[model samples]
Target: MRTSAPAAVLFDMDGTLVDTEVLWWETAREVAAGLGHRLTDADAPEVVGRAVADTAAHLIGVTGATPPPSPPPPTTGPPRWRAPQPS
Candidate 1:
């Protein structure tokens, strides 16, 4: 292990690395729309950079969504294809 002072560190607090912020915003907007709620620039504080569960809970509260309850019992056979395996 080399333990001199570190040469550098990297962080992406505001998406300079890959700029997925817009994708996150767009997806949140679409989901909000599906929940019969509308999201705008004003909603960013509650939606952007939030954990998925937190955002999901926020949407549920804002739109009175129950998020469809637990999933229905699994379908059998064909549509229930086996889980994928890595090569």
Candidate 2:
């Protein structure tokens, strides 16, 4: 399998993989606002991976969404993966 190309690839991960502490979208909106530009709520999802020029263009095109206040970092605890005890 390692030597051959995958006929079908499957991606899998636990909920741990979903953990993210940063709010880059919020940061971008804040910076844009500080630069005298406004970003609305509807515009955030579209801004995720594009270049700065493209993002700015999208914002300009949509007239931007009202960016909400930054959310607090997601609270986390130690993973609960534990071995079962013998009865």
**Every candidate's lDDT:** 0.75, 0.57
lDDT of 2: 0.57
TM-score of candidate 2 on Cα atoms, chains taken together: 0.34
| Pairs of residues clashing in candidate 2 | 39-65, 40-64, 40-65, 40-66, 41-65, 41-66
Question: Which residue segments of model 1 deviate by more than 4 Å?
Answer: 1-16, 68-87
In candidate 2, stretches whose alpha carbon ends up further than 4 angstroms from where it belongs are 1-22, 49-53, 56-87
For residues 35-65, could you state the per-residue lDDT of candidate 1 as single tens digits? 8999878888888887666677778888888
TM-score per candidate, in order? 0.58, 0.34
C-alpha RMSD of candidate 2: 13.0
